[model samples]
Target: MACGALLASACAGMPDSGDVEAVKASNAGDSQVRVYAVAPRDNADPEEIVDGFLEAMTSDDPGFATARKYLTKRAAQSWKPEQSITVLTNAPHRGQADRPGDPDNEGRTFPLTGRRIAQVDVRHAYRPEVPSAFDTGIHVVQQPVGDGKTKEWRIDSLPPGLVLGEADFLRNYRAVNKYYFASDENWVVADPVYIRQRQDPVTRMDPVTQTVKALLEGPTKWLGPAVDSRFPSGTELARDVRSLAPDDQSKLRIPLNGKADRVSGVVCKGMAAQLLFTLGDLTSVRVEQVEILGSGGTSLCLLTKGQAEQEYSPVREPGRGENPYFVDDRQRLMTLEAGGRQPDKPAGVPGPFGKGTVQLGPVAVNRTEDRAAAVLDNGHELRVGSLTSDEELPEAVVTSVAPRLEDRLSAPSWDGRGDLWVADRNPVKPRLWLVPGGQGERVEVGTPWLRDGTRIESLRVSADGVRIALLVTRDDRTTLQIGRVGRGVVDGHEEITVKDLQDAAPRLESVTAVSWAGPSRLVVVGTEAGGVQQVRYVQTDGSTSATSVLPGLNGVTSVAAPYADQSAPVVADSGNDGVVRLVPGANWQPVAKGGRVPVYPG
Candidate 1:
């Protein structure tokens, strides 16, 4: 049960003389170093006795010898042959007897497991008996354990008495044999316990000790005041109510069948506020509504199931199947399924679905006459109906066309843009696809080099549709490549490499997004150890500078420079805490409290 007993038993096979010599040599430079002895209990198992000896050294009972039995042979043989170990005196006590007639219990008695534990507190003293072997200041304490019956106890487990030394006592002794066995008798005492504890000066904070007081205490002390402080008046409650609709006179409707109180309004963008309503473990709620702030402002627009019916059609034709589509009634963006239609089948040939010319269904948004578009998943595009919807979508007008090579037909951008860039990771050709604008055709950009297994971690396009920035990572190193829209060669295009910018700011990990900060300057948002970095580039003069805009953020995943003045910088962080923080200016202020932000109104 002794702490060192296990380690001692574990290293028991090590040669005793070599271990002793090594310990002596390691202590040669320390004048105060001394060895203690332990006595073995009568009738104790040899293995258990050795375990107890090691345990006393380490202030634990199971001992080093017993613990060493479980170690691999390589670990046991790695001990130095010429190390010296200290022994401690024995303080024995009897063990409690087991209950009578216990089937599993043997009549074997042992030492008191708790009382046998001891500590040989090593004290480093300055004086040395031999000036040549020991230094004036360096001192060490060594605690050696042994059987309870003899004062000459075999060293088990590393003696705790050795100060500023390795846990591997034998190894230390072998490395510094010249300093071994030089003890100071003046420092030796029958009992060497109860030493005063010292506190770390740099980190410790003592209210009474003004001279030793830390400057700012711990790290939490620096941040705790702000995190725990109260918010500005009405700022907390201002975000409580749902934001009013853009139009003052619009009506609001509830989409689901539940209590409105269950919904929690998280954020408001322009006139619409995003709400999260909780129903039960099986269901959660999300709704965007327009709130009325005060007089003259419009009533909130809460879309109801009844109103949604007026906006959507649920009929399925034999030739044209019905496609489920998502619609935001507030935004008037109607998503209708398209392309899942079938033509009459021929006499001998089966259709796509074992019938005839099949339609995969299409999604259309009602805007005006002759302007409706349909999207398909297989990279195909089509025109659904006239932009002006005089009636329900006409199936006969659907026309299929090749998608833009750079278009992603199936997965559209959340911003209602028909064309979204998606990297084709088909292994054969890694390329970028621009999902056709308004769903007509897709355009493929970039070279086949992407198919050669280069991973594109992030991609960003300039607002003017001229420049494209991509963060490509290979073999744990990330490289930023910026190219013009029509360019196939990344290096050949007008680009900025991240490696070149390391001289100015060394902590930039990866560039997430790039935007034009001004006519002659470009803003680069990067992920750094301290958080998001906002770098300003003067392209005309080739001058660049970076500032730590956001601190304590894990990484910046996305960045948006919405305003021309670069006053509003929107950044998304995908860290342990998934929060999309908006830093407006020099002092970064969080626009949204939590992760998901409201996308209505603005």
Candidate 2:
């Protein structure tokens, strides 16, 4: 059946049921086209030099050599490019102060300041370390040139890291996943980040070295503690080599610095998997085997493509997702096992979910299939319960303490590590939190970019646990954004934060529901124009195709496709019909007609 049902209620507002505010139809396409940063000239002034150097930092120029032109030879070599980054919204203003109490002024401090929004350290970490009253200071040295006819002003010292506007940042950097294993050492989760990729595709510049370097730079702030890596500290490629291009045999010999030498055999095996997965992430870098080379070009280990699976693997598509499950007309959680056409309602274990007057909205089943999280009492509260109703819904792990409409929580999601992730939109206590499965202690995660006047409408954590899809509404416009989840440490305690929040479908006007459809793709619903409800495919990096629409299914209140399938079966919460699954190039098979949210195993 070509299921066609459209209502303003279908793809708008919070999940479950509630009084929903209507939003205008809008279109969010794929990407915002950006140009490469222009290189700076040699004879610019201190102010221009500073600005140009900062701008050049966004460029994927080899080694940032172009940016080095703005500094003195000594400063250029001493400046640590990765020490920290100051996120700014505008151009920095230069102010100079002469030496205090000096009748004859010898030197001055060049102070540059702007509206610094956020700061990140080299570890790709954040912790309010960048002060609100932050400013970069540069020491100006007025010295004589060759003939001393003309004075040359060179920067002696400057603040660490780079600074750039949000616009330039979006244009210049692209977010890619660095793979890591879940806490239980079961599956790999991605650590997503905005790293600069070489823009000039025509040059055929290999990103392997760069990607490996960023991977070596370590996981971002929010993901550090949750995951582990085999790559040792101070890990770097030999100074003589920058890129890890493969040879004719499709083998890459990654020469590591001394830091990785003299390692145990078991550690070598783990390190091999790390290099394989890390380098394999780059779109341009293709290799069949990765050989770990120690100092003096000693062969430490080699990992073939096939061997990588045994040691460790990615969480992208673990081949573990199950058939669609949803609440039936009897208010019970039922799995749809194909029988004839509709489905057989095989009740999971224990009592039926959403029985009687107990209403349930969206339900998230962890990848392990042992438990599921759901919203109850008409969005007034959230509970993590056993899928088979084996245990009473987990004691309202999250709820609307504020009793405000905006304070309502979204359905919970489970990462590969089996952690429960939920969001609270209460403007007073807007937060993203994690509940370790079966555990009560609530660990609050931070979202630094969540500005005022914008509230989270819907959220889904990635299977990997490193990325999240958020439906945010601001000024009546609902947009789909993707955020990188990470972790940091302070005073021996762990802190979690999300970084590099970017629009995944910026051209779409309204996005009702979003679900991970592949490793780097999302199935998004909403209209490009005319309130024409349709399911569209979108990339996590904010790239969408104008014609990438799944036309048949309309007015889908909810939808689910395997995160690894670009053209996976379409599981839809069809209006008034409950739940249905439309396999690719196949007919619609009814699962249940009274279910609202249809989901695949997490």
Q: Write the per-residue lDDT of candidate 1 for residues 131-158, one digit (tens) a residue.
A: 1111111111112234434432122232
RMSD of 2: 13.5
Evaluate all candidate structures by whole-model CA lDDT and list the values in order: 0.28, 0.65
- Per-candidate TM-scores read 0.27, 0.60
At residue 303, candidate 1 shows an lDDT of 38
Report how far residue 34 has shifted in candidate 2, in Å. 21
After superposition of all CA atoms, the RMSD between model 1 and the true structure is: 27.8
Clashes of each: 114, 20
List candidate 2 segments past 4 Å from native.
1-259, 263-267, 279-289, 304-311, 314-321, 337-357, 388-394, 401-407, 426-431, 447-451, 486-495, 498-500, 529-531, 545-548, 564-568, 585-590
